[model samples]
Target: MYTELNSILNTTPDSFTQGEFILVSDRQSDASFLMHHFLSFYLRARCKVCFLGLVQSFSHYNAVGQRLGVSLVQAKEKGQLIFFEGLKESLSVLISQESNTKSQAIDFLRDPSVGLRSLYEFVRCTVSSSSGGGEKGADGAEEWGPPVLLVDDLSVLLSLGVTVGTVLDFSHYCRATVCSQLQGNMVMLTRCDGEEEADDGDDEGSERLHRGLTHQCSLTLHVQGLPTGYCRDIHGQVEVCWRRRQGDGQHTQKKLFQYKVHDKGASFFARGTSSAVL
Candidate 1:
């Protein structure tokens, strides 16, 4: 793992500049370790990078928190702060890497060392709202909870007890309502057909869902556990089909994909090529 970290660190900044953030969607066999080592390397290298993970710091705090002087509540806030700080620093690295925001982000992750530098910055600056006045809300409505937009393979917009008119509505709600406010977004989706044999005869149904979504959704983020040849065409608002792969015993659930939509269409992106089309 360290060897891989070294190789990642050795990568040229340009290599990172060419790609977007790679959000690790599924937690594979060594997913946690992979993240741990990747982050350790990034921290050691002082790389600037962002991490999209489930908000589970409270459990860590509750387990061994008495060691710190702060109360459990305070400790929890501190943890959240740490998370946001890391994100901001990664954002900074994204800004500094190149002339454009997107370009620098590519560089920040190109090399493990540079990427770590960014990640460390993010961790250092983030402060949890529990610490103080952190996450803001609309009309003091209490910072909106993470906005969840559930979509099905049939491209049917699954209602999370709500209805969103267009793809942009979903993005804006997720962004302004949640990601921007909470600093993170959560997503869950079913894998493509044949990846895991559908217990029922839903292969054709799921494929239909996936293809039907191509027109309405403009963003597609690539992450772990997805089949090969998967690609999204947000610029043209099209979905590019790729060859399929069988599941290799990975948990593709509970993964989140951060997305942004523009006037032209929806552009899907995540920590990596793992896409989430809007």
Candidate 2:
């Protein structure tokens, strides 16, 4: 699916595993394009995906997928993709009467819950059901592989009034659940807001949250817009830094790339060449 990108990450087909947690940080404007590239890679690899789109509608994702020739609708129909409907859930309190009639509604508003519990439950159930009472292969191994869990933006929860500590706890719980219960991988996209004043406590708090999650992640990728002005033929310039966990500790690598946005889709390439590395 993404041979060069996987090579950059030092992943080999024989050595691939599902336990890693990847955290991608970028400015809000550039994050969407990068996320689409990342998700397309996994989806093309035939990995089942559970997507939690916090900042965008499912239709937006589907449109992007179509442009990229990923056929997200077909993936969903084949039970290879599951969307959690984060946009709908976030607005549920305001638009739906079902919540008002149930005790869940009161808890939803009063508590700082980011709705991770429900998502976790859903993933658990889906995995279990997919197993079909523990279907086995010839050698007594599981017939199916672990799924990939993708969360569009964690900062959306913070914007919705979820505390940093609560969000961290929820993230940790999700990581643990995926690794231990589902044997899957998790990829989370979050914004690194650089606009806040240096002395602002909220800014400090946001930085702390970003650092906290970066520390927990097995791989951390930082995307920054290039300083040069945009060109007619270029969508934008971006520098990507990848830090991966190694046996001894952590190792860092980086690359500079430019992207082009076309009417149908977008593509990224290493600087000065057509070779794509992201």
Candidate 3:
């Protein structure tokens, strides 16, 4: 596929083409490659590009926003201008950009427009800031915007001109936000299955002991330091449990697992999958 795409790209003598440009990013780094390619194509095409695919890092968005002088606050103020009012406006913007021969389509696919709208709804639904519709208290104090995800206290965000609305919107779809704990702690676990055989088998009693179970499970933990602002080592772990064969001719078991997160790396041991609090 790479070779074929390259060949087609090389065959196009004209730098700018009228047809739609589609780029697929299979992984996070692929997104970076896509950005690099779009910039290269944009130079030749000189067209406004509508980005698609996942913008993995807020850093990427910040980089682009800095280039365009568009911050979260600015986006809110220039909402309709940048992202269009809704999906209709978003599609309209893309179509308009597509019409320009010099424009390049750089669609990053988080559905930013949709994400923003959902966030707006969540704010109205959850927190009662401006987006939520409820006014401030009698003292004129207002509820601060979205909670910040940081390794340390994020008072800086407030001074950085980040509003509750912007923070609420940003954190809505952030996986890190969902898993993170107070004081910047986080734990991530994945479930896996494996099979094993008993040492004794063949005998009726042994056969019962050696009967192979088709389904087995294990858990892997990916732990990182809280709010480091980068993927860094962390040190922390809590008890975990696993259960199997519960009720109605099913086996059941549970265990405790501990893990630690450090700046340089992390460590863990496999344990059964039962719910546990550490």
Task: Encode model 1's per-residue lDDT on 93-191: one tens digit a residue.
Answer: 555645454323223333433322332232223312322343554445233222222211112222211122232233333333233444433222323
Candidate 1 similarity to native, TM-score: 0.26
Q: Positional deviation of 20 in candidate 3, in angstroms?
A: 3.0
Error of 2 at 240 (Å): 4.3
Using TM-score as the measure, what is the rank order of every candidate, best first?
2, 1, 3
Q: How far is candidate 1 from the true structure (C-alpha RMSD, Å)?
A: 19.9
How many pairs of residues collide in each model? 51, 0, 41
The number of clashing residue pairs in model 1 is 51
Which portions of model 2 show Cα errors greater than 4 Å?
A: 1-7, 10-15, 99-110, 113-116, 127-144, 195-205, 234-244, 248-250, 263-267, 270-278
- Give the C-alpha miss distance for residue 66 in model 3, angstroms: 11
Q: Assess every candidate by TM-score.
A: 0.26, 0.77, 0.20
After superposition, which runs of candidate 3 have C-alpha atoms over 4 Å from their true positions?
Answer: 1-8, 11-14, 27-31, 52-278
Which of candidates 1 and 2 is the stronger one according to TM-score?
2
RMSD values for the candidates in order, in angstroms, are 19.9, 4.8, 22.9
Candidate 1 weakest lDDT stretch, 10 residues? 21-30
CA error at residue 17 for candidate 2, angstroms = 3.7
